[model samples]
Target: MSQKVREIRLDQIEANPNQPRKLFDETKIADLAASIKANGLMQPITVRPLPRKVGEQGRYMIVAGERRFRAHKHMGAETIRCLAVEMTEDEMAVKAIIENLQRADVTAMEEARAFQSMLDRGYTVAALMKELGLKSRNRVLDRVNLLRLNPEFQTLVEGGNLPPAYACEIATLPAALQVKVIRQVSTGQLKTAEQVRHAVIALREALAQDDIFAAMPAATEKEVAVVNRMEAKVEQIAALAALGFKDNECTIAKKVDPNKVKGMADKLALIRNHLLQMEHALRAAAAQGEILAA
Candidate 1:
């Protein structure tokens, strides 16, 4: 396989049909094209020979330069600098994927899909793991797991609204529960990933009990519902407080007596304490059930 750098016409070069990467941002591509127009192509693309067929002249197939090709097209450049090479289909696919991964802004889903593609193309998980500088098999495995996430959740991740840590948390949940958690997050019921994680763990623990329905206290449901509502209200108040409203000022500004605010604060604290006690009692009941079952 000879390697020679040459200036090839942009119209003549074609993107590899087997490129593992699926999505590309037009804005980023246009930006890159503008940059390339201002500064000549610093790096050349890699390509392989395309076998000719009857009644048609073949064109060069890109192996590792899809971004540059698209950018140059956006720039309206007639020709592009490329490095011609010869490689088998499998090698070309890997090179195409690795080239995209080298970009700074590649999405996690893209990376996951690319890795999965390589795996499907006969690469071992261990081999790809080493190639990607992954520390453990589980790290590689986790990327693949992202593919299992619902498209709505995946879109959230790709859009940068949801963090990967949160996505991982959602990944452990059943699809139906994943939708529930996402809805809560979207509706501001769950403020942080930590809150979601705690809720998930608590729910799992509750469900694991043999007679979970009976093991739980009769008042537990009502208590928990009240606590959730109160917590939401507290969060709203805290947000208001963060905007420079003191408890006393808010109360007085609303024409309520300052003493009333103090009294309410004391009452809320007491309610919070009672909620904690209710939680503890529920836990104790569950533990007793576990002991009896054992």
Candidate 2:
């Protein structure tokens, strides 16, 4: 691509329509404007020639350094320095992704949407890793997964109140459970990514177990140690219950109907699995506490 440096009028320049970055901090822009006013622009923004935009005078579109362009406009400058490059639309899109991603100016959600945009354009995860200079496949996928989170959690990620690591774990839950985790975080109940990971796993397992209980609830109880929103307890009230043996043999108690045996066995297996999960969750929470104490 051909490239050269020159001065361009602000009115003749339009922001790139395909810019990957969506959220820009006004305070930072104002700070940039102040810096430019004091020391002149330390670096020129890059732009390419484009047709005029509707209802706006435009001869060029920004390929990079939009913040600098905004800073110049903020300072009421008539002309700003520019690095003009020639590239096709596809090349321009890739260039924008690389430029913004290389810097730390964007939020996690912005990076996610940008990665998604490129993926939608037919790029594979491996191709994206190579193109973006990212090392880990999970790293790229983790950012993209942030898109699955609700807008409220997304805003927390964007604002830096919640790190993307913890948010990714929370994103694996259903909407209501996601809100539950968020509430826990806000209340300082979950303070680490490890804790959040364990918590989400428990919530997911609890969800599956809830479905089973709802389908085959022998009895319900009002209170439990775990705060599940569903009917929290099931007690066997059958006249002749199926019993589990430690010798790996399935046995139905005397007089138990053959049709009811499978259901009883399933509930027994589910309860056993749930206990194992609860044990693991407890261990994980304890580990998190130890980590914090250390």
Candidate 3:
């Protein structure tokens, strides 16, 4: 790599195609330019020679220091100090990504994309961890997983409006329902990452519930709380049933009246009869051979 601190013409330099940074704040740029104008560009930008095309000759592409370049452009300077270096395209991409990532404002989505781009080019996770100076594989994987977020939520995460961890937790939900989870988060209905995860689990359970229950209209907060308590009881009963425990084992279970148990049995028998009737109805419909065998 040839590295030289050379003064290059601003007009001859072009923006890097593989730069990980997509959005730049004009206000921040103006501030940086003011700083540079007063301090005289404390650090230099990095650039590489570009192959001449048509009327252009001795042109360069920025490998790093895009912010400074923009600042200089804001100042209308004719030339800027550049650390000229010779690097391959891949090397240039890595340098640009690394440079951008070193900044505090680099978005999670940008980091994820930069990591993914290197990974797609045959780089291993371990290699990425080392190059990116990450302490663990989980850190790298977590950033990369941000790509799984829905576009709307991804934008939120990338813009720093939504926490990346919240988005990551919500991304585990079904693709169709991720946005709803994000909405819940954005509205402060879901507070923590754990809450978002639990909400997702509950949403999935609701989606997996029997059609008769799932099709019901939305309930009030108190109604939802009641249903949640009932669901918990149903789960406990299901576990007990699986264990072949016919009688009550706990104090709460023992508090139930015997007549209540008998009434529940009668209701269960009625439900069984209803199921049989449904099967019979389906069998009647099977005459045309449209319905398959159970």
Candidate 4:
């Protein structure tokens, strides 16, 4: 239920533990505090009543507008404006995440962390896209993946020192690779986002070329053709055998050929051996591909 906006003591209000935002820019808060001092607070922050403790009576936990709360606190305003609302934990978390994501100053890393919190609570990507008004599943996935970024890169992105888009591009890479690329950006060796993109591409391609599997001999065009023909041959033989194995029309005794059975067993063993070898080679190739892409 909604309660009327009222004046609340700054000391009585508490920051929400579930608040999505972790970092608040001091300069922005100072500017906001100055604005509040000059124009007065234009909007009342949302809060929920906290259970009165022995000495901490009449306190409230912020449900939204934490930035405003901080700003008001900064200005040493004894009494501030607030609207009290009752909300469940999930509701409060959603509101906090939405409020922060909608704000211009919230960093990409913060947004990503908020999205991840919901996901950890069992929310699906499709549900998050709908709730957050994101246009695509891929976009939501991108935001969630940002949480996987290297801690140092996340700090740079959070501090507004690194371009978010470039950080996201490297977030797809392994953590070691991300640190290496970000170090180049930090050193100003890679001046522009475009330069970073080109460098990443060149690095990935170089890694791919150096892959051990890439050095391994691949199937020749003729070998590929031969493999296809062999598959067809096996299919034809299987079909023929199925036709003869009719439940009512054939019996093992009637169809028995001891020599042919022995021949078939030998061939199956050879096939299994060939398959094992192929599987090993394919596994090596897959591992190499992952490393290059990483």
The candidate that achieves the highest TM-score relative to the unseen native structure: 2
Would you estimate the TM-scores of all the predictions? Answer: 0.65, 0.69, 0.68, 0.64
Worst 10 residues of 4 by lDDT: 285-294
Query: All candidates' lDDT scores?
Result: 0.76, 0.81, 0.79, 0.80
For each candidate in turn, give its C-alpha RMSD to the true structure in angstroms.
13.3, 10.6, 12.2, 14.6
Clashing pairs in 3: none
TM-score of 3: 0.68
- How displaced is residue 54 in candidate 1, in Å? 4.7
Query: Per-residue lDDT for 236 in model 1?
Result: 88
For model 4, the stretches where C-alpha displacement exceeds 4 angstroms are 53-56, 187-294
Which digits, one per residue and each the tens of the lDDT, describe model 2 over residues 160-216?
999888999988887777887888888898899998897788777666766776898
Runs off by more than 4 Å, candidate 3: 53-55, 203-294
Candidate 4's residue-wise lDDT over 1-294, tens digit each? 667799999998889876778888789999999999999899999998877768756989998888898998898889889998887777777888888878877778777888888888888888887788888786667777777787877887888888877876777776767776787787787888787776667666556655755788998999999999988987896686677666656455366687687776688789789878977876765654553454
Quote the lDDT for 77 in model 2. Answer: 95
The full ranking of all candidates by TM-score, starting with the best, is 2, 3, 1, 4
lDDT of 3 at 115: 86
Cα lDDT for residue 294, candidate 2: 29
CA lDDT, candidate 2, residue 156:
92
